[model samples]
Target chain A: MMKIVLGSLEKLDFRATVENIRVVESVEQLSKKNNEEITYFLTETEENINAVVRNQEHVYIPATSLLASHQSIGLHIYFDLESYPFYQKVKEMISKEDKPKGVFRFRRTVQHNRNHSLLTGDLYTLSSLLGKPQDIRVKQTDLSVTPSHTIILMNFGGGTMAHIEYTVSDRERIELEWSGIKKIIEFDSDQMVSIQSTRKPTQPLAYSVDAILASARKVDQELIDRLNDFSRLINGGVYS
Target chain B: MKIGIMSFAHMHAYSYANGLTRLPDVELVGIFDDDIDRGKEAAETYHTTHYSDQAGFLALDMDAVIICSENNRHKEMVMHAAKAKKHILCEKPIATNLADAQEMIQACKDHHVILQIAYPVRFSSPIQQLKEMIDNDELGEIIAFRTTNRGQNPGGWFIDEDQSGGGAVLDHTVHMVDIMRWYLNEEIAEVEAIVDSYFHEIDIDDAGLLTFEFANGVVASHDASWSRFTEYPSWGDATIEVIGTKQTVKVDAFQEHLRMFTNEKKSLEYVFWGNDMDFGLIQDFVNCVKEGREPSITGYDGLKSLEVSLAGYESSKLNKTVHL
Candidate 1:
């Protein structure tokens, strides 16, 4: 059985995803869920995680970024844009194929605001898609505003490092870029991921939603598999 | 403006030197380090002269010196620079202890030198904007704060208690505490802390959580830990959430970058692309020197921040709340 405990009850689309899955609004109702049931939380606090853990319910954390983890993750969503085509081109470049050689580094700085939880959630999702990081470092550079900014540095070992700057600003937009020893990648959320390699003077292939979505699906499957293994372990059975 | 970097012990000296060289009106006079090899290499990299003797470097007729020495050595360097009547821009926590910090401040005061404490976050564009909003009452009256300044354990002298004074609590706590003081314009009254060396085999504490009570009734919590793993992104973070009576504001000072996942590296990397806080801070220091004005961030600011960290240590030792 699958159940969702949403902080709000207004979202109806989520209820239709699975037929046998139950949906609830409060933590009280979610805690009463059977041990065999899988529960997804839309928004949960440390206190809530503790409560669920104590209740012994099989909890699957979907929003990994929001909750503070061993690794630092950050995300920011901006809605303002001047040109759609330009944005599309940028997005395509970020999701491009001819990947940069050597260590890849990424960072984002936003204006301070009150949406840190959401930004963290987005980072968590992105990190999940990337793969498990070997090491994680998070620094809170400044925190005098509502959406306090943090610099999350992740080293995936074997020379892969990521530096993210989470910013909260009045302006709404997205920008992405990658810098390597011999290559550079740049993209916007709606644009293509573009790769510029020194060795390959010619333009490299770009990536779009189709590619990113596939990766996202893969991450989702991995999470589910891990959760299943965890359930099996708790039930005193080995995962098959 | 003429500036000489005192040491190359801190990695930030590289970035600061780059910033110094970029200014049209400023000249990076030279670099001095007790370790001649490191100093010579850094000077060569930045295209500046390297001085082996401390006295020789102090007598170079520079208007100011940037001290990037180890934390414990700050007092001695500051004293030497101040005696030479050179203005100083010293790295954070001014000194390891209150006595040392006070002595450094006094030395600078006696010599009539500008002692600017390096609090680069104050110069960050986003942070500056947020400071303005708070000043304008955009967030109304502030109620509380949840701040974190976490980074990966920087081994070597940073982990050595004698050189660094303490570990995460001393190295990380002051940065966020300084910001809190700047935002609230208040001082910490009482402190409670839990410090431990849970992650590494360090003798000093590597992780800490501190709760502070301000005189103005604003309570704040700080997680100053070197809890980040080696593979974690960036160096670390300094994040703050200001909960006000009207609304809450979150500030992530280092959140300007691009995200890249490459198969070649087989890992995700975040490439930061934000206004350089170090550049702005150096610019401010240069401007203050040229204009003969006090830097916005002074030695007193460093002292106040250091006090909180010191209090945190005391609180942890006593296993109870410590009053300032």
Candidate 2:
């Protein structure tokens, strides 16, 4: 059995709020304050995540990188938007807009520690909603030293236009349009599973805890891959 | 606690009356309406006395009055009730304009009585939960907001500019704007809007899209309209979507329902089941009066939210953003 030591929290039973995993258990090693014996740390941002493994050389994989492990969270067409809930309302708005674009502007926070920026995470999960993107472009709105607020517009294969907004804000949502028929996704934390959208009679998108473990195996699941891909794309991956 | 209702002009008075009935400790002392027949009918339905004279009703041994008068008549009713030393719960879009709303608020303050605005949507448990989360900063720093409060056009005085103030923008905008402001704890910095009579033949606007930038530069856009026509499954919806650095939260406060396909005349209906927003508001008001505390939804909140809807009209007319 792989030894997993918990942090901040004394113990947690994932029997509820998550599915398909028992890798989590209360361990004796957590009480041993030597600091070097623990190989895996399961902690939240409030637990002082930086002081743990993230600040040191123990290797830190943020929720954005870890949640990207599953291909079901992958960029593939589940079905047309017609099959989606609120179909008529979405259809009515689409017909009204001559461009017929579906925007998904959302924000992602970076784990800043001097030179390194937590490169990739939320964009991959939200981009999957529009299926695989046929093309992607970056438009930086706010002038900052470290791309503090960036507006990335994507053209998906299914003809949906997504605008991904990144910055510090008190809320998070995936909108169909800036001000049209929209679907807002609420999360307690970024690593939440069995997620429920509050309205539009929001459909819950659930993932198994096993997928989180599967994500650890795929090194490319790190946000760094998307950042590299964006660089390559910007360096002429495809010409308009 | 003894509470009387003033005016049967706004239909919400009926719901407020029903809410009064649910509370074991509160009594519906009487009702006063400019329309005698309407007041009498409501009094009979709620099993309360009807006072045709506004002075007669205000003179009653009541602790508070719920003013469900016309949008234009709110100021008069509120002022009368305040001087009578009765705490007030006035309906949304507190007055037709800012000055009246301000004066109404000031009178309540001077009289040292509680003045609550009837923004029942905030009593929603999910919305309350979201507010708690926002208070705790569970989502991080909130960035932008998108909201919708669409409803079927209730014909009658609601369409009359003199009685109802404005159309869809006035009727539907306050509830959501009040919620947004409460959640962010911020005042609007600017307003931009497009208002038109697209759904109806009325001169007053039946549709509007309002955009607001808060004092902190947090932006929000609200689609307030009376576009939900007859034969729709429900009367309307109150939906909100917010984006923050941490996560997004979206809620349709009235979405708790079972869709019913009926063979009856009404055809489509949503059999709603959830925490009663009106009852909650009534209970809170009763608690405020009993506990001698401040109201949950204050007159100042009403004034600020009203300021946005009023600005919307000006923004549409000027074809430019109205800076507050």
Candidate 3:
């Protein structure tokens, strides 16, 4: 399970039998890492599209590297028709014998002028298959006098990574940036009031046919049939 | 058919009048209010005949009379509409009390007239979308919900307990509760609330924090307050966030535009200014009247929400939970 980073490939993880490793400058030196056996890597390349179409088995795309590649090479994300091989890997990591769990102190505070008030406070569950250090703490803090502020403290088994801080004076024009960490994928909250980074250990998944079918199992068959019909209508963009 | 507005005291009365004019089938017949000056002024501006007396106004033979009178006067106005055999469009919290609301509903029912409560959010497109999403389980089984129904403290009749029923909890709580019941299509089994009068220095509670437990183990909390100040330039704001096992779905019932920003700090940009949902509601009322169908937010629906508000108030008073 690799955490996708937006900019650099500092903390990308690729767990596979690293068949062979060689620091090569050219295509000829890239031969050892090339074989029928596929290996996942935390690096992006310019030849990804052609490499995949040619079925170059040894070449691998890192999850963290995809965002940049997508932007640079116009690598658009579509429905994963053929479930990527990474799903099995993630599932295995999730069910592994030695898993680490930690708790995060989630606190949301709103500050206006000299007044600071706590909006929400809770403890959250955090489990990781990634290697854990002796002590890992993830948290957010700021001193700027803003109308509101949200702080999340992730007590991870590994080192802490805090990425984003946002403030709204007028709530119309927003300014966003990343510090302490760069590469991350953020999802919009349901209210569109906030954008939150997906918690570690979970990958971003939008609704699709598989989810629809899975949930529809105990539901009414007539409703299932209607939903199935709807899926087709939406995907095909044809009413009938 | 020619339509006539009876009062301009409540803000909703203007919305209803505007909605009526938007329909091709109805025309503005006349306008009247107990306050002669305000009634005459609105009539002149909206271009409708100004009636001096309540009796004279009803004599216009209008198809309906939308009772947007003061909250306390709802019963009298509704009874008058029922007696006139006109279809009734009553502003919600239907009459400040269950007995009055029930009587109004019965009066309309007995007279064979449509009693449509003006819970305009029921007619919103986003709310309809939220309904579809929940029905499809786009959000898995809903575990909890947090709702905010806030507006500027328009004190007058609204703050006066005798006039506006009880205050913010009474005037504002019904809309969100009705929305909750409508969205879940289920009855709330129990309610616990902490209601207070924090915003305005009033004797009655102007804010309510209520937690509702549905029969299906779904828990929800509502924030109904008259805390929006005039400096904000917003009359009211309503939003609901529903959390489920797998996902969350929210409806910004009051606004439309969504914008995002991040610089020295990140923030969201939300503005709900452009569209008019009131027209949709009134249009539905007209369509229902013509087609002989029940209004989307019916009298029964209004009663159910009022019941929840009443229960919440009772819960707060008793300092204990109430079983609905």
Query: Please, what is the TM-score per model?
Result: 0.62, 0.63, 0.58
Candidate 1 lDDT over B36-106, as tens digits, reads 99999998998889998999999997899999999999999999999999999999879999999999999
What does candidate 2's lDDT look like per residue over B295-324, in tens digits? 999988999888899898898787666898
Real contacts recovered, all predictions: 0.00, 0.00, 0.00
The numbered model that scores best in TM-score is 2
User: How far is A191's C-alpha from truth in model 1 (Å)?
Assistant: 21
Task: State residue A48's C-alpha deviation in candidate 3, in Å.
Answer: 43
Q: How good is the docking of model 2, by CAPRI class? A: incorrect
Error of 1 at A12 (Å): 10
**B1-324, model 3: which lDDT tens digit per residue?**
656666787988887887887778798888879789988887887788888798889877788777778888989988887888878788887878889888988998899989998888877788878888988888776665657687767777777777888788777788888888877888888776656664556787766666677777666666676666554434567877665555656787767654445342334334555467788878887777778787777788888888888898897677566897
- Scored against the true structure, residue A60 in model 3 reaches a CA lDDT of 35
lDDT of 1: 0.66
What lDDT does the true structure give each of the candidates?
A: 0.66, 0.65, 0.55
Give the C-alpha miss distance for residue B36 in model 3, angstroms: 0.5
Instruction: Report the Cα lDDT for residue A219, model 3.
Output: 23
TM-score of 3: 0.58
User: On residues A75-138, what C-alpha lDDT tens digit does candidate 2 reach at each position?
Assistant: 2111111222333244444466554333333434332311112223333444433455665544
Q: Which of 1 and 3 is ahead in lDDT? A: 1
Q: What DockQ was computed for model 1?
A: 0.03
